[model samples]
Structures are given as structure tokens and as C-alpha cells.
Target: MVSDRMNSRAALWRVAAGQRGYFTAAQALRAGYSYQTQRYHARRGNWLAIDRALYRFREFSDLPAEGDEQLVRWSLWSKGSAVVSHATALAAHDLGTANPSRIHLTVPRGFRQKSDAVILHRAELAEPDVEDRAGYRVTTPLRALAEYAADGEDQDVLDGAVAEALEQGLVTRRKLLHAAQALGARAELGVERALGAML
Candidate 1:
């Protein structure tokens, strides 16, 4: 026979599985773990405390987290309102030489946040601008390029991103050209110059 305790643990495991073995205290509550039980698990080493309200199964502590896991952690931190963008998105798409020192996240125009680990861009993103990644959201390569050009990043960096994205077939030339034109002058010029040899 199955006990309710077993059922609750199983339920929480299901949720944790989807989050790389991580979960929030509120999520534990929804999985039938009371605050007292949550405390007990943390103290007993069944759960590893990650932040003020975040945790992961202790079993996951022994292994290294994947790159995308950072995205998930930040997405969870933002309560799923952030989309990885800019140089980070460029790297995610594997089309640039950008080595972003901080994670770049795009949040709603009204969103306000502060963190040394992240650089937040505020915009009301259109649906097509974002793409659902493994367990998080990221700006599409097209959107990423437009953002990079608009940000006026070093021209050399922009050229590298555009060239790699085109050679790797990550974005169609016509689509990229269209995206750049829509973003206005400077962006269009960057894409144009990058496409020089390819054109």
C-alpha cells in the first residue's frame, strides 16, 4: 500500500525533475510539504538550500550544473519573466566571439531588478523575438543580432556575430536583412557590412 507521505515525495520529485532537481519553497508547499516539513528536509540533508527560498535535492549537489542550468536558475529567480538576450543570446546561438562577463536577460519594460551577475534589458518583446530553449527562454538569433546592432557594441564583435550566424545557417540572409532594416540605420549597416564577403 502507498502512504500519503510517499505520494507527496513522489509529487515533489516530478516537479524537481523538470527543474534540474531544483525547486522553490512555494513549490514544495504545492507538492504537499508544509513549511515545517520543508525545514526538516533541509536540515536533514534531503534538500540543499540554494538561496533564501530556493533549493535542490541533495543528490544534485555532487554534480556540476550545465550552462543552461544557469539560465533556468535565473528564469526561476525572475519567476519566469526573463528571456536570455544580447551577447548571451549570441553565445547561446553559437554565432559570435562575445564573452559576456555577466548574464544578459531581457525583462518586461516595467520589470526592475538589480544584480551584479546580470545585465537586464527592458523591452516589450514581440512573440517572435523569443524562443523557448531547453528549460528557459532566449531571444532568437535574429532578435539577438538586432539587439547587438542596436546596442552599438564594438563593430568588430557585431561583424563576427553576423558572419558566424550566416555561415552556420542559424538565420536566413533575407530574414536577417529584414530584421536589421526594421531596427533602423545602424543595425542595417552592421548586417550589410558583415554580409559583404558572403554577398
Candidate 2:
């Protein structure tokens, strides 16, 4: 019995280590923790509740909350469907003058997580439009720019993003044009104007 308990604890640690010390209830169950055991751990202060279904190892409480750690946590809470996007993606790519007060996440059409700290957009993102950054999924530079333009972001910020992406070779005129066209008329026109100004 003691060996089984030790193995379970080891498995849980392995899962939590990769997720900034966080583990979901589903993950806990998969790691051999019963619901009653989870409740006992929380009551004993061995686990810190991050949300309704998420818990963190108290032993890793010293881990600094920096960089994309929070984003990764939220993505895991979202069951791996959330993709960082919009102004947040622009900031991630270092291509725009975007300063978003809230983290932006793009999920699939049926996603439903409501939180004031996060702005969630629902859309179907193709594999090419998403890229992994710092262990978190984020929209590509071109997709970020197009989404920002579609959302009616500041003209100056959009322009700066275009110039930076072009200069960094993160995006080309043709790719930008294709992305803009995919967003329809207003976005296409805005991206065109930004590209024209850069040339």
C-alpha cells in the first residue's frame, strides 16, 4: 500500500512539474488520485486550488509566476484548446505597439470560459495560423496582425506591427494580403493601407 501511494505521488509530481506545478482534477484522477484523496490533499494544504478544477503543488509555490506561465496555466485549464491571440499575440511576437490590459485567448467555436482577466475570441484556427511559443500556443505574426485589424485595433499599432513583421521577415506582403483577404473587406482594406504606407 505504501509503495502504491509513493508511485501515485511520483506520477502526480511528474505531471505537475511540466505545468508550472499545476494539475487538473482530471489529471489527478489519471495519476491515481481519487476524488476523495484530492479533497483530503486540499484540506491538508498539500494542494493549492487555482480554480474550480485546477490545483497546484504547495511544494512548488516558490516557482516564480513570470513569462508565459500564467498563459500556459490557462491553456491547460482550457483543455489544450486555447490559443493566445490578438493584442496578446502581437505582444508575444514583439511586432506591435499593443498594450492589452487583459490576456487574449482564441478558442474553438464551442468554448465557454468566462473570466474578466481574459478576453476570449471563438474561431476556427487552422494549424498554419497557430504556433507554439514558450510552451503556449499563439497566433502567427500574420494571423495576429489580421485578427487585430479585424477587431478594429488602433491604426498606429497595426501599422507598427506590419512594419515590424515585414522588417523581421516574419511575414511577407503576399502572406499578409492573403490573411487580410481571409478577414474580409474592412480588414483587407486596412492591411492594404498599412502595407502601402510601409512601401
Candidate 3:
């Protein structure tokens, strides 16, 4: 008979495989496995911890290629409040050349962080300012650029993001000013000035 530990590990493996190498403790618990048992197996080399509260099938990484699903899973660990922002957002919008070293996330004020790879910031987001992009809930292009400005993005980056916003007609100077006021001390005049130049 397979021992309970082995059985739980098998279950974890199945779930992690379905989730593209990443599964959270809550997900495993929902799958009729014990979180503590899963941790024990991970310590024993049966599983690998990825992000905080996330585990990956160790063998999955040994495979020859990466999958879009893995990126999606990492994004999910951030919950719905996070938007792929900063350098990543610029890449997404095709507005800049800088590649971010970490996964930048513009999160709401009260959301908790669950991953070391995520660089999180607090922001006030309105419902219409957010939309789904590639299975991740992200700030709209204009809102993302504004948030980037609020977070003190460099002049070139700010200019690129603002230019994209203007091209898309998603933001106006009035909108940025309102957002800047809401951003308060977190707002950077550097971003605001660049955005003004675009206007």
C-alpha cells in the first residue's frame, strides 16, 4: 500500500502539473491534501518551493522548455490587485526597451505579498481603470503609465509610457492631474512633467 505521505505527494504532483509547475498550499488543501504534509515532502525533496506559499514540481523545471502557464501561475500568486507594471508593462505596450529584473506589480493598498520575485507597490485603482490582459488583471495602459509616473519612473520610461497612453487616447492631462493628486507624496514630478510634455 502506498503510504499517506506518498499518496499526498502524488496528489500534489498531479495538481502542480496541471497548474504548470506551481501550486499554492490552499490549492493543495482544496485537493484533499494536508499543507503540513506537503511541506514535509518538499523538505524531503519530493517537491520544490517556488514563490512564497507556492510549490513547483521539481521535475518540471528539468524539462527543456518554458511555458506561458508558468508565468500565468506566478502572476496569480499576486492575487487580482497586481498589474504587470514598470518595465514589464512598457514591454507589454511595446513602448520601451528596458527589461525589468523583477516582476513589477502595482497592487492596491491592502493586498499582501506572496512571492519574492514580485516587487509590489500600493496604489488607488478604480474599477474602470483595470482590465484583463493575457489572463492577468492589470491596470489599463493609461492607468499603468500614470501609476508608473506616481512611482517615480525615469524620464525616458515615463515619456514612453505616456506617449503610448496618448496614442491610445486613454489618458488626458486632466486625468493625470487627478491621478497625481490622488497619488499625493508618492507622485513624482519627473513623471508628471514628462506626461505634461506629451499633452
Candidate 4:
């Protein structure tokens, strides 16, 4: 019985191993931890609460500063339904001149969680518009650019982003045009001008 309990705890650690040592209450339950057990661990300083339902194993509290683990943690907190988007996605893809202070995430239109640390946009994202970046889901570079442009990002910033994306071959002209068109008239006009300047 003791061996079985130890194995279950080990399984929980394995589950958190891939997520920078973070895990959700639901995952802990699946790994045989009751709510009481979870609280005991937290009280014992073996786990750290990241949010209402998210936690990190104390052993991995010293993660590197440069990785997207926090973003991935937020996405997991969203139950995998949100994709990093807009300026945040631009930075993730390294395709644009974006430097967002807050993480931006796009969830389906009905997602209700709100946080001061996260900028949430509600939208329906097509599968093609989403991609995996460092294990986190994010809007593709062209899709992110179109969304950023449609949201009235600064013209100079938009232009620079478009130029950099084009220069880096992160997006082709046709795909950019298509994404722009999907964002409607204002975005199309802006993208056209940016493309013209690049040409």
C-alpha cells in the first residue's frame, strides 16, 4: 500500500515535469491526490500555489527567466482553450516588432476568466491560425499581425512588424494578404500599405 501511494505521487511529479513543475488540481486528483492531501503538501511547502487552482512543485521553483513557462502555465490554467495572440503572439513567433508588457490570450467568445496580468481577447480561431510555440499554443505570425493591425496598433509599429515578418520569411505575401482580407477593410488597407512599403 505504501509503495502504491509512492507510485501515485511519483506519477504526479511526472505530470508536472513537462510543465515547468506546474500542475492543476484536476491533474493532481488523477494522480491520486485528494484535496486534503494537496492542502497538506501546500502547507508543508512542497507545493506552491500559482493561482486558485494551479500549483508548482517547490523543487522547480528556480526555472530560467527567458522561457515561456509562465505563458504556458497561464494557458494550462485556461484548460488549453486559449491561444496566445496579438502582440504576445508576435513576440512568441519572433516575427514582428512587438514588446508586450502583458500576456495576451484569445479564448473562445464565451470564456469568462479575467486577470490583471493577462489581456484577454475573445475570438474564434481557426486551426490553421494557431501553432505550437515552445509547447504553448499561439496565433500564427500572419494571423497575429492581422489581429494586431485590426485592433488599431500604431501604424509605424505595424509597418515595422510587417516588414520584419516579410524579411524573415515568416510569412508569404499571399498568406499576409489573405489574413488581412479576413480582418476586413481597415486591416486590408493597412496591410496593403505596409506591403507596398516593403516592396
* Decoy 3 TM-score against native: 0.62
Candidate 1: residue 174 lDDT (0-100): 94
Task: Give the candidate number with the greatest lDDT.
Answer: 2
**Tens digit per residue, CA lDDT, model 2, 61-123:** 886766667777788778889999999989888787898999999999998777888999999
- What tens-digit string does per-residue lDDT give for candidate 3 at 94-155? 66454666777777788866566767766666778766654465556666666666667576
What is the C-alpha lDDT profile of model 4 across 74-191, one tens digit per residue?
8888988889998888887776568888899999998988889998998999999999755369998899999888877777778888999988888988999899899898888888
lDDT of 1 by residue, 1-199 (tens): 2587898989988987787888889989998899999999999988988776788888766778676777777877777899999889988887778778999999998887667899999888899899987667999999999888877787788888888887788888899889989888988887887777456
Candidate 3 lDDT score at position 1: 34
Rank by lDDT (best first): 2, 4, 1, 3
Which candidate has the highest TM-score of all?
Answer: 4
The local distance difference test score of each candidate is 0.84, 0.87, 0.66, 0.86
CA displacement after TM-score superposition, residue 71 of candidate 1 (Å): 0.6
C-alpha TM-score for every candidate = 0.87, 0.88, 0.62, 0.91
Off by over 4 Å in 3: 1-20, 40-47, 58-81, 86-88, 111-118, 133-135, 168-199
Model 1 RMSD in angstroms: 2.3
Q: Can you give the lDDT of residue 89 in candidate 4? A: 85
Better of 2 and 3 by lDDT: 2
Alpha carbon deviation, residue 74, candidate 3 (Å) = 5.2
- Please give the TM-score that candidate 2 achieves against the real structure: 0.88
- Cα error, residue 67 of model 4, in Å, equals 2.8
